[model samples]
Target: MEVVQVLCMKGGNGDTSYAQNSLLQKKVISLTKPITDEAISNLFCNNFPARLCIADLGCSSGPNTLFAVLEFVTTVDKVHKKMGHELPEIQVFLNDLPGNDFNTIFKSLPTFQKDLQKTMGAGAESCFVTGVPGSFYGRLFLGKSLHFVHSSYSLQWLSQVPRGLESNKGNIYMASSSPPSVLKAYYEQFQTDFSMFLRCRSEELLEGGSMVLTFLGRISEDPSSKECCYIWELLAVALNDMVAEGLVEEEKMDSFNIPQYTPSPAEVKCEVEKEGSFTINRLEASEVNWNAYHEEVFSRYQKIVADRMSREKTEFVNVTVSMTKRG
Candidate 1:
């Protein structure tokens, strides 16, 4: 709940907005396209639904918000054509936390709907899209209401920071200096959150319905892996640097925890088995460069900014990220 109150992305198409920084997220959706295609294949193996209900959980406000959704729409249209079945009426739910810039998403829908109509041809009339705002950690829809669900680069966010991390000092998340207790707290929290997530989806999805989730994950159990918590470690370093200049209170740094976790594949599999709801059809992972765009551009930009801020007494850089769905 605190995460919801404090969690908001860089709204609008500004320099630091999620709308601009989300190119990496768009890339993740593309990288996981095969998984989504396989899930859609299973969804339509039998008679396709005349009216199909799909939900894109953690659909943040950005130009790329509809990128994955349109892919699904096209795939569904193609499969029905191949099977000689009528195209289904598609009702899409774009979900995110309350703090999301839904205005941006809604504003763009007018153009999106028009483009979709042109692309979908006669099938356009059957397609409907609406926004569903709230957390996905709990039940969000009626029982058996959803046929297919997709989440991209979300779900790593815990419902809240793990309990008992207040004792953790000087770091915002699990880092090299973090103790065993902090790691244990994070692990337990993830188990609880992931199991709850599965349970809720189980109630909402029809029998044999499919879901595809692509989020940040660890390659191993080590919590300090560069893949696991390097981002947080860097954040801690930056915050502590500010504290040294008497800019930020030490207590503030100690109290704040990044309300997210990068679960290992084994951890996710274990939770699914414990939940005993959905059958795991496909599980795969691959490493990709963190910067999907030109890395040199960022390096040059950082250098220019560092030169200008040499004697700054305070630094207030508000980086609104497109990671609320579960990042």
Candidate 2:
């Protein structure tokens, strides 16, 4: 699939919009606040830049869109105030796929700005927010322009579906039934995409800049572990039911694969080290219950999801890392 053209969360503030369904992501932000705060604080104290440029990559529109950025700004302001240092001017960039609803975020800017004013007082006027539309697997900022970078609950998404997936039939992702070759293809794709991500960010961030990234991951080395692949496995089950009933085409279903990967902590560490651009300051893992249900899909899928949830611990393994750009 053309992930860049199609891989976006549902837009607007309606009942089924991502804005309403992103409690899971919001919970993630809350869970990782300390890591984010520490990174921003460390970046601020290192150089104390007059203008702090911050970018939130894959910042899909919704209440969670600016949530992390505000926290960063608040952290810097709090630290500077306590240290008796002048607060820096904050430049915030919210980036996502071009298909994202930047309008909704733009409309919410007035309230976001007001909130910042309450926190930063006079220095709030110096804080500016901009929307950058594109993929984060490539460059999105000028060289050495950013002081701090944060990406949450994204980056698991591959730029596109991996090739050689004809053998991965009847599965939407790397499932327990997937062939060994299918698993290798997925891992290689993640290695390439993730390495590119680190290289791009390294070029954009200053030597002392910090980055905190949080995304879905697996605890087990097995790519088909329930923690990471079960959700999509359930999804494939639902689609197969539709196909059997003649509601969906079997060929289409067989060809479809999710353009995402949930890497294990070891897999993540491997890519980071292989890329060789950033130093890992902290790496941790946590689990959160899966709370998202799509309204667009038929009730059968929802029922399958509900049944699985009731019987088992349907949770997402989240890996959060804090790193600094190598000098």
Candidate 3:
């Protein structure tokens, strides 16, 4: 399936919407907060821009959206306050696929502005937030425009499904049942997409600029390692369960695969080096247990999954693929 056509965090603020079901993503943002803080702090202390431009790529809508923006703005505000200098005009660019539910974020802006005003007080007035709807795999901003870039639980998503997997057999996304060729396709797609990511950012970021990214990654070189890819296995199980009931075509199941891949830190480093744009100042890997989710939220999520499969099988695949990546 075409990723841009299908890839979206379930929209709106309803139960199945990414807004309601994104606690795991919030945790990722939180887990990476200090790193985020340091990146921004380094930007300011080393050579602070008069007008700071920051982009939150794949910034799906909901609380997590502004939550990241809040952390970024707060980092700059605190650094400026400590330095006793005028705060820079912070331009916050929120990015995601065009299908993302920007309306919720837009509606939340009034409150966000108010909260920022309340939190940062006078300095908050300098921060300007705008939404840019597009893919981050390609150029999204002007040359040397952004200072600090943040993307959490995203980047795992490939720009599209891998090529030449028409007969991958009964599996979806880096599963043990997948053959070596299938796994290779996933890795190649990641290498391409990630190289593009670093390449594009290299152009957009100023010298001495930095980026803090957190996404699902494997501790093992093996693609079938549970840490690397159990969620998709479970999702395939869920869909196969539906197939047992004749709700979906087996052919659909065979053809359908998630447009996402998790890389090991070594793989990430290799691609970053191969791209030869940005230096790897740091690389850290963390894991979140699959059972960390509350049962109530998961039940709602499962219902949405079944509904999406019934409505548009690949649509369910697309959204839940994103959800599991975040988790």
lDDT, model 1, position 19: 91
**Alpha-carbon lDDT, every model:** 0.76, 0.89, 0.77
Question: Which one is best on TM-score?
Answer: 2
Q: In model 1, where do residues sit more than 4 Å from their true spots?
A: 292-327
Model 1: per-residue Cα lDDT over 261-308, one tens digit each = 887777777887777777777676656554311343344444444554
2 or 3: which has the higher lDDT?
A: 2
Model 3 clash count equals 0
What tens-digit string does per-residue lDDT give for candidate 2 at 60-102? 9888987777888888889989888888788999999999999
TM-score of 1: 0.88
TM-score of each: 0.88, 0.97, 0.88
Model 2 Cα RMSD, 1 decimal: 1.2
In order of lDDT, best first, we have 2, 3, 1
Model 2 misplaced stretches (Cα beyond 4 Å): 294-296
lDDT per residue (tens digit) for residues 163-240 in model 3: 978767677777777788888988889888888888888888888778888767777789776666666666677677
Worst 10 residues of 2 by lDDT: 291-300
